[model samples]
Target: MSDRFDPILLSELIASHKQKIADLGVVIRYNESFEELEDKLPIDSKAALTPHFATALNTYTSANAFWLGGFDEDDQLVALSAARLDDLGGQAMSEYLKRYWRRCYPAEDGDLAEASETQPRFWNEVRGRVAYYGDFHLKREGYQGRGLPKVFGPLAMLVGAQKWDADWYYTWVRERDWSMRYPLAYGFSRTYFPGLRWVKPPSSIEPDLAAGVNSRSDVLDWMETLSRPGEQALNK
Candidate 1:
């Protein structure tokens, strides 16, 4: 895709979103423990990793939780946010993920095979260098302009800074999602694979390659303005 984001325009977009949030009295807070956050958010059974949700959360060695909610004069869980973490283990991780991919995407075997073959290459590109923002969910009825994911820009950056101190971050989204634009605002570039790509390992390990793809410039522009409120042209 060609450049669609102008830094000034993106700043305005983010500012507008923030203004909408402030007007609604919405609050965003981080949850250090799963128990605290779980009590509030609804469980998504249709999630690709539904069966392993709790296991994944509980087993995560480097995970953070955040909840976006609204309260009256008093506090309560009116809305929520939930996300998990995973280290894309080279070949071993690929094997582990294949099982889940097979279940969630049974018909995608050919794509998975190709991903597997490229696993070593991809992992070498990612590995300890990148952190995957597994999944994020927001309540349907929460006070909304575009919903929490649109506002999740700062939260994701915070998580990355505190947990991984990562150079880059990545997440997979369904092909048709409108939210795909949100990540770009936060500086995550999408990878273009010919088919659904699976993580595969090389027959032999080789030197790591330099990072290539990245979030589009417009997305990066928005990300840069996140920490500076006055600099932010977006509402909020």
Candidate 2:
């Protein structure tokens, strides 16, 4: 739904990278001809639709989304990640934010339900100026230590930035991922705590952290190395 980022293009770029990843012994696929996968995505899960999931599905349904899957050499799904773009900073946007954010983390510093109180400042400062990336999930088994985040993170932001020309980008990541230093290397604050979670990360582990970036850097340039045929077509 965002005018700034080309979800379709990013999806294509990701899909084309599958062969390169395959060359490394792991085959990955990004969204290509997504509509054909409609029956494939929601047919297996039966978990209770939590507010968070519901909202995420809504965002996923929007045009600003990218889905990636890492398949075994046999073509079985081993790892996957999905991300969506969200904008904040207006009366309508504030309400949409509260609808889902309150369920997870809604405070300036781990407060857990003050989004309304902070809506003005959030709206005033970041509304329309910033873009948020959320609903990203990556499984651990088939893709460990393979530098997925380094590639995916910057690519997502690049598409987001290209679409909106927004001031910054943010995402919620578990504490462990935060401790790894990749996010900080990409330009997000390492110690900042914008929101505390209630049931996020499934309540059995550490809370998630909201990380963000304001501009491009060398870390983003690393994405250039990931270029493949899918992206080449975009340039022409």
Candidate 3:
């Protein structure tokens, strides 16, 4: 829980995180409340309002996307990140992101149509609360190595899980990108199901092949490092 963190330690961690990026000639701002972030996304983020990036913007039917932003010298929104806070404790979790896509895009693709039809089956294996770790975007190249992922990713997870009061955490990564995703989600187990995948590039992280956490301790343990180079399980 947020209470477990030492205020001074957390503040120091934040300052250090900012300094890492600032050293690369960038500025960062972390917003704890979704209200301030929901008001007019940055110019680079206008693509998100179009529904394709809604999940990245942290916009969900019954939830707000806890977000963080990085900007260039002129403050023009160079990098932005977010995580989804929604209930997958039951049918809610099943819909997770698919619902958002359907509501906004409305059966635009072959896979989405199939996913819409296959939604019920996907829910069968989903239960308990779930938080989605996603919506990370770097407007420009050469910035990822600036320690931004380490700085923003976990902080987004920390805030989003706290915001939604969720201990169940998960994220999507296409199988094609396994090398990158698996390392980030070390403590989560992959849950496979029928048609439980991204509708478009369903293979993006492999459908139903998503990762999840069962309790707060796991979330906390993982957050201790976010992702260690070769962590084999929830804990040593």
Cα lDDT, all candidates: 0.43, 0.47, 0.51
TM-score versus the correct structure, for each prediction: 0.53, 0.54, 0.60
lDDT per residue, candidate 2, 83-166, as tens digits? 455655453443555556656534445545433434433333334444555444444565667766544455445555554555
Evaluate residue 222 in candidate 3 and report its C-alpha lDDT on the 0 to 100 scale.
Answer: 51
Counted clashes in each candidate structure: 19, 4, 9
User: Over the stretch 87-117, how does candidate 3's per-residue lDDT look in tens digits?
Assistant: 5545655555566554443333434423443
Candidate 3 regions exceeding 4 Å error are 1-16, 31-46, 49-63, 88-92, 95-101, 104-112, 116-128, 142-144, 182-215, 226-236
For candidate 3, give the lDDT of residue 112.
42
- By lDDT, the better pick of 2 and 3 is 3
Q: After superposition, how far is residue 63 of candidate 3 from its true place, in Å?
A: 7.1
Better of 1 and 3 by lDDT: 3
lDDT of 2 at 124: 35
Full-model lDDT, candidate 1:
0.43
Using TM-score as the measure, the top candidate is 3
List, residue by residue over 102-193, the lDDT tens digit for candidate 1.
Answer: 44332323332223444434434444344445435443444445554555554544444444444445554444442335544444545433
Candidate 3 weakest lDDT stretch, 10 residues: 186-195
Mark the regions of model 1 whose C-alpha exceeds 4 Å error after superposition. 1-23, 43-53, 56-58, 61-116, 119-124, 146-148, 178-180, 191-195, 198-222, 225-236
